[model samples]
Each structure stands twice: as C-alpha cells, then as structure tokens.
Target: MVNTFQQHQHAALPRANHDERARQEFTKSLKQFVQQGLLPGLTPVYQTRAAKAFEKEHGKPPADRWDIRKAMVKDLYFQHYAATNRIAQELLWEAVIGSVERQLPELEKAIADLTASNPAPLESDPAFPVPRYVSALDIHCMPGGYASEIDGKDIAQGAIYDRGVYLYAMGYMGPDNDDMGRSVCNYVKRKMPGFQPKRILDMGCTVGHSTVPFKEQFPDAEVIGIDVGGPCVRYAHARSKALGHDVSFMQRSAEDTGFEAGSFDLVVSHILLHETSGQAMPRIFRECHRLLKPGGLMIHADLPPFDLMDPFTQFILDNETYYNNEPFWGAMRDKDQIGMARDAGFPAETIRFDTAPMAIMEFAGADTTYTEDAAEALAEREFTAGEYAPGGGWEVLIAQKAA
Candidate 1:
C-alpha cells in the first residue's frame, strides 16, 4: 500500500503540465527514497485558495533565475503550506548522517582522487568583510549571522540554504526564515506585484536575497542592495553579476542609508525590524520616509509584532524572542508598522496590500488571535494552513504613501 507521506504528496498534487508533474513526482520519489522512505507532509495552510492560486501560477512554466524572484515570495511563504518543513529539518540532518554512513567510503575515495588531481578554487578573496551588528548577533540564533562565510566560519549554512535551493527556493530561507537574508526583498516584490518602481532600495539586505528579486521584477529600475556585511555584500554583488542581474551591493546601515532625500519609489525590508532595538526602528522608519518620493511606498515583511494580533497570538509570536535568539522580536511584535509608517510620514490614510487575493484570503479576525495552548500547537504545526489559521505569524502587509 502507498504510505502516508507519499499519499499526502499525491493528495496535494501540484497543478502543472504533464512533464512538470512528472518531474515533481520524480523529485518527490527520489527525496523519499534518499531519506529512507520518509516524505514530509504539506503545511495545513497549503490547502487555502490563495495557495492553490499560487501553485497554479507556479505550475505553468519555468523562467530564468532573474524572473524567478516573482515566485520567491510566494514560495517562501509556502513553507506553511505543508508539514514537510518539520520533517525536512529532521530528515536533512539524517541525510547528512546517511551520506556519511552509506556514502562515506565512496566519498572518501572521490575526495582522495580529486585532491590528488589538484581541484580548482572557485574564486579569489572578497573585497570586504561581512558586517556585524548588535541585532544580528542575538536576532536569529545565528551569532555572526549575516557575516559568516559558508566555506569558513560556520561552513554548513551559506551554500546549503542559498545556493542549494537556487531558483527553486527564490534563493532564500523562507519568510521570517531569512537564512539567505532575502526575506525582506522577496516580500516587497511579491506584495507590490503591480507597481514597477523606478528606483528601489533594499535596507539591511543581508546577503542580497532580498535585493536581486527587484532587479528581476523591474529590469529597468536602478536597483541597489545595501547591508553592513562586507563579505555578504561582496558575495551578493559577485553572485548578481555572475547571474547577469543589474544590481549594486553596498555597505550601509538601514537606520541611516546615507542616500539623497526622495531617491526611491520603493524602499523595502524583510524581517529586519525584529533584530533591531526598539530605539532603532523609529530611526529606520524615518529614514525610509525621507528617502521615498512623494508617491512612493515603504514596506516591510516582518514577524507580526504584538502590534497587529490578539493577546494569545501575541504571546505565541513573543516566544520566538526567547528561544529563537531574537531579543528584539517581542518589541517589534508590539510595535505598529502601519502606525509607524503613518508617523514616519507615509501620509495618513495609507493603504496596505495583501499578496493573496481576497477571494483566496477570506479576510478574517484581528490577526486571528487564539489561546496559549493553540499558540504552542501552532509553532509545531505552523506550516499547514487549513488547520493552523487560528495561530498567526506569517503576516503579510504593504503600506502605501498618498499620491
């Protein structure tokens, strides 16, 4: 008989062409076998109409890496669509262990053979060092978060999450899962799908994951990605140039970007605020206000600070602050980005956009607040949608300035 996880995958079949369906099926089967017959389930939320719509659009055809950013935001958000992430996390380590246990002998022989022949180095040294910040150290359970090189310092992270997924993952660690630092930028691109800004600025764009998608979204726009990390910026720039995307990476602070006033039509960030101290948020908000043109917009895709949701949901979101290395997360959860944007001079009566169409999103409660037990259940079962909607975290909103 077909097993539970494989059964689940088939149950949630993706809407794609015959060949694409075949490929996805093959991929799933390979993953299942490779992981010793384990198949992670889809998120409870994956069954929503919005998710279905996204899957429909995604199933159509493949695009270049540049064009793939359009898919990045939704794909990142798709983490909540299946229960697979939880299993994937556990299985990934298993895969590593299995690779060691089963494939080690062959791997050793291959390594010896390659070393004897003198393998090639990928590239020369970078121009600068990756940045360090008070927030980055404590924000994501990743000390030296954005600065650590995949090859050296930590060794396991950089290549695994970013380069490994490539276009398939929008080259990021998913929403609020900013392993590649792309969360902030991908959120902006997906949220403002219609408006093509002339000049785009990505604040605190850790590794440029958040920055490159804008270039793909608006090929004509002058796109610049800035971050404090020297290594990440250097790596990001090199990656962009190699991929032929016209993007510029710089070393700068989001609190004070040091750009001319009214320089951009869109200024966006992803998962940036929670890491920043409460004192820093106001300044960063003010900076965007000054940099944006009269009709421009400033948007952020961040963890839902207690500001938007209910007491119960608020507490749940707050727990990440304790366990997830996000010291500033609770304060961010409590701060109002909409109110902050309005106060930041985004013009009163701002309009926020929801990426999922109303038909798919079913406009619900005040951030869908729930009880404490529900919240804990949510963290574990968050990837699924239909069942876990009561506990909210992946909140998506876009605030616009008056014309």
Candidate 2:
C-alpha cells in the first residue's frame, strides 16, 4: 500500500533569507557553547562554592535545591552563568523575530496562499480567547508569545517559533523538530504492537512540528492538531500541507476541544503541560480523557518530573520558571502526573511513565527501527545524578481509559 500521506524528507518552509540563516546559525552555536562549554565548566565550581557557603552559614551542606538556589544566587559565578544564558536566550528570539519582521509581508502572503490551496483543513476562530497564562508574558521571551497577530493575517509568531525552536533545541529535535512525536510513536509501536489508533489528536501543536510525524507513523489515521494560538494553527496547517502530510489544524483550547466524547483513539501533547497553569492542567487532562474513546491512550511528552531528578538539577531546570517567564514549569515539574491522570478518571494501574530516545539524527535516512527490548531499555535507563539534561530525550506519561 503506497501511502500518499507518507512524509517526505524534512524541510523548512518560507526558506530563511541569508540574514535569517546567519542569525539562526549564530543562535545555534551560541546555545551549544552555553550548554556544552560554559555550563559544564561552571557548574562544579558554583556547586562547591555554594556548598561551602551553606556550610559556613548553616553549619551544613545545602539542605535542598531551594537552599542551593538561594545561596547560588549570591555567588558571582552562578550569577554570571545565569545572566549569560538568559541573555543568549533573549538574543536568539530577537534574531529570529528580527528576520521575520523584515519579511513579514512576503511570509504572510506565502502562508496565506499555501494554506488556502492546501488539502489539509485549517479552522480558526476570531472569537477564541487567549488564556491569561499565555497572555501574561512572552514565554521564553519570544516577543508576543504564541498568540500575537499583526495586520490581521499574521503568521509571524509561527515563523519565529518554527525557526527559533531549531536553534533552541540545538538540533536534538531532528531536522524539522518532530522528534518528540516520532519518539512517542516509536514507544507506542513497541509497547502496544497490536493497538492501532484510528484517530489521533495533538494538543498545543505549534506549527505542527510535533503533529505531522503521527501521520507519518499512522498514515491511515485521521490526525488533527489544535492550539490556542490562531497564528500558530494557521502556519501549522500550511506547514503540514507543504510537507505533504494530511492533517487538520484548528485554533482551540485543549481544555475544551468541543469534540464529541470518545471522538479520538489517541490524544497527545508534546512539552505542553509546563506551559499551562496549575489550575488548568487537571482540566486539560480531564479533557483528554473526555475526548478519547474506550481503551483510548493519552500520552504526554515532557521533561522528567523533578522527583526523578536531583535537587541541584531541579534547581537548574527551574530557572526557567523564574527567569524565562515560564511560570508554570516549576509547578508542572512538581506534579505527580500519574496521580493527576487518575484524578482525571484513568485507572492508576493503567498509567505508565517512561523515557524515549529522540530520533534526532534518524530522519535523514538513518535506521529508525527499534525493538521492544530496545524501547524498554531506553525507558529503563537509570537517571544520572546531578545532571540537568533537558531535551536529551523525552519523558513520556501514558494512560489508557478503562474499556
């Protein structure tokens, strides 16, 4: 069976201009330098300094990550490291947004034409309200966050995210930033070889980077991607179309997708929980439950919970909660996702947590196959103490509703 919907080689649309390309490269390199060179060298010195300071003051080593964070804030080395990383993060989005702003009219026209002619459907509501959590600040310092629009038909937010995320991820998300979905799909195939979903839903699917891969993996399934951001869905629909993947992109809140109950067989979200408010997360989970059919699977891919990480690593990861305007990351990381799922009506015994190796280098003709044992091995890999490895892989929380 030749699947016409099979995705071709990954590619970026509205090709970056020379300046944009240069900026993206610079951002990528800067991020790599910060993560690999600067952070690794400074962490030990900062830790030692912080521990000594804590002992001197409290007659003990730092009792917890909070104590370490408080002491480290006073240390010059930690201060410099945090400041440098934050500045680089801001500059990355600035570069991408600057490039996009310069070509806004052309990019908008291109997206408009592409989406209009594309077979994949796009539905957006002008009346859709941007949640206060999203509107409060520019998450990750991306100007205007994900919902902003300009000139009534703007795709700038999507363009910025699409371009900036590659640099943000430092290529760990594969060529087209679809590794989260691909990794989750691989895990599902290995874990439940006999289970096949007829309908798949991706929530908070920005620009469809994490949405299209499901169509690639389950070519016959009806794949739909939804986000609260209109500009995001608009661009996502166009991007999926451009990539020759069949998908439906809609502007809708995950908490209330307006779909009939039990309408889907699989519901997934990639790195979305951390961006949602504490008050809204349970509702979102409940909505996932409501949307899925009997025996349907709900899978969420995100960073490992703080309980699975060392205190120092937790402190390091929580920096985004304070500095990067991602207010809910700390709360989300502290959440017991299994408990939350159970509260949302999924059976406790049906919930599972695991990790999946990212398909970072696989999409470009590398062998993408995995055995069941290999998947289990990846999931069971012991957590290394004291390292904050975000995007090193995906931590998946999965649940199945009672049949």
Candidate 3:
C-alpha cells in the first residue's frame, strides 16, 4: 500500500534538496517494501522449512524465541530479510545525515532565530553525566547517538533524528510524529473525565515530537519535556517553538530528575523505556511516582512484553536487539513492569495495561496529508510483528498515585 502520510515541515527541520529528497524517499519506500512485502514471508518460510530443519536436528521443535531465532538464522530468506532491514536503516540515517550536514549552519541559525523569541525555558547542563547506555554506542545506528555536539550549541543529532525518524516509521506516526502523545492525551480525556492536570512532565522526550501534543491538548497545563541528551533538548525546544507551543525543554535524566516532589499532576513518556538500561527503568518509574502529586498518573507507551506474544512474533521483534543497536530492546520486554510500578509507590490496584487508539484518524483533514481513508486504513490493519506500530493502538502502562 502506498503511504500517503507526510511530515509537517518547520524551520528547525533540515531542508532536503532534490537529490537528497529522492534518496530519503527511496529509503522510506524500501523500508515500506520490507515491512509489507518481505516480513510476512518469514512465517511461511519458518513454518514450512526452518522449524522442520530445527526439529530434525534437535529431536524437538523450537521452544521459544531464542530457538526460533537460531532456527531462522540459518535460513536464506531470513538472512535476506535481516540484511535488507539493516541496510534500509543505515540508508535512512545516511540520507538524512547528509541533508543535515549540508545545511547545518542554516539549520542552526533557524533554530536560534526560532528559539530567541520563545518564552519557554530551555535549560541544559554541560556537566551532566551522559549515561553509558546512551554514550557508549550509536543507538538505532544514529551517527552521533543523540548526545554528540559537533560545534558550539550543536543540534545536528537532533535534526537528524527529527527527519530520520519520520522515514524510519515510514510516516506512520502522523504528520508531526506526535501520535503517541496524542493517543495518550485522547485516552486520558475519554477515559478519565474531569481529570485535567495543572502540571505535566514528559520524560525522555527526544526532539519533543511527542511532547508538543500535551500542550496542545491541555493548554492550561504547564508542560515540560526532559531528556538526557543536550542536543535533543535544544532541538526539542526550538522545534516546539516552531510548532507554535511554549513548552519547556530541559536536559534532565528521568532516573534522577531534580524536580521538587509532587511537582507535576501527570507524567508521561512515549517509546522511551525500551531504550534505557535494565537498572534505570525502575529508577525512572520511582522518579515518576515522586514527581506526581496525590491522585496523579504515570503513563508509559511502549512495546508489550514477550509473554503477551507467540515465540515466532517475539523472535521477529527481537531483531531490533541483534540488528539494530537497541541494547535493551529484547531484555526490556521481559522486565516486570507492573511489579516495578508497584515498587515505585503506585498502588497496585491502579496499575493496568490499556490500549490508546491511535489518534491518526483524528488528524484527518487537519491540514496535512492524513486523509480519512488513509488514516482508517492505517488504524484498521492487522499489526504484523515487525511493523512500525500496532494496528489497534499503542500499548500503554498506566498507574495512579494514592489520592
């Protein structure tokens, strides 16, 4: 299916020229082809041959995702599939990186110009220790790993992520890449009436793609987006301004944010947990519990656990850990998130997993390319293992602090 979704451009975004745009579009199309054309074939390849070969050799069928992985690795089709995905990811970043580098000076100036008049606070600390998990390697094959600064007040890595992630998701994240936050906001509004928060915080908010939606949804609330990446916060501040929101952006780690206790009424994160180390997730959860006031809420949107899916599906999703540079991708799925939340001081009875339907359909006719038909198609499709997002909705882990 042709992806009709398009990103809404702003001053902080890198302007791609004719050739660069073509290369970026090609990478997006290639990724789409891989997900649509190649991914489904894995099931047949495994059930018909790979599993049979493993059973023949081991005297039993493959037991779990690990066994599935071992069996699939020897298959030629799986090799091709994995190779193409890695190549496409590399190409996606390369295409956007070149575009950003070519116009780095111009992009920086645009960010400066846009941020200058914005009233929101943009705080950063040069001495803040970059966690080893983020600083050690380039996560998602990103060239600079989200924290690198090439020059003074550098925001190159953030710029690369801003555009690259759109292509990476194949534009399934809506025009502004705010679907996760928007979905969560919609969930709160519909599920919890009369629960308007006065103060809100978003943790690990890279580039503020998912951060701006909260300000838009709850205009009266004081919204702040925090991240450990300096460049990411800088770019997020500028991007938030360019998008016409006065949300605050700060360089802060969720594991130990210095905010006062009970400073916020609602704390949220989108697709952030799986990227953090095992030791950090629980700390982050505790911090969230501490940051929220009585009767407040903590909501995290991320991948569901391995126990919820079949072994074949688990193996397919685990490809991120092996091929991509996501170190905690697979192991994170095994973590006891509910138990961690309980330990974090959230009441056990208040903790539950729920689906926040994608707000894509709500974006229909909202000025971008999100046509009603296209949004419906995206929201109604079956979620394949390796697809960008689940079809029904994003899986959200939510808990409420004691009142």
Q: Clashes in candidate 3: how many? A: 0
- Using all chains and alpha carbons, the TM-scores for the candidates as numbered come to 0.53, 0.89, 0.94
Error of 1 at 110 (Å): 21
Higher-scoring candidate on lDDT, 1 or 2 = 2
- Top lDDT prediction, candidate number: 3
Per-residue C-alpha lDDT of model 2 across residues 95-171, encoded as one tens digit per residue: 88877788777777777777877787789876679899987889988888999885546678898888788778775
Question: Which tens-of-lDDT digit does each residue in 1-403 have in candidate 1?
Answer: 1221111111111123455434434444444443333212222233344345555777743233222323332544433322343343333333333223343344334423432332111121334343344524633333335554444322223222232232122211332122222323334444445777899887776545656666765778888877655445544554454344546767677888779998899887766777677778889988988898888887776664454454434433443564445677776666766777778777667745343211101112224433444333322222222222232234444556556
lDDT, candidate 2, equals: 0.79
Q: Tell me, by TM-score, which candidate is best.
A: 3
Q: How many residue pairs clash in each candidate?
A: 25, 0, 0
Evaluate model 3: give its lDDT.
Answer: 0.88
Model 2 error, position 180 (Å): 0.6
Candidate 2 C-alpha error for residue 398, in Å = 0.6
Question: lDDT-based ranking, best first?
Answer: 3, 2, 1
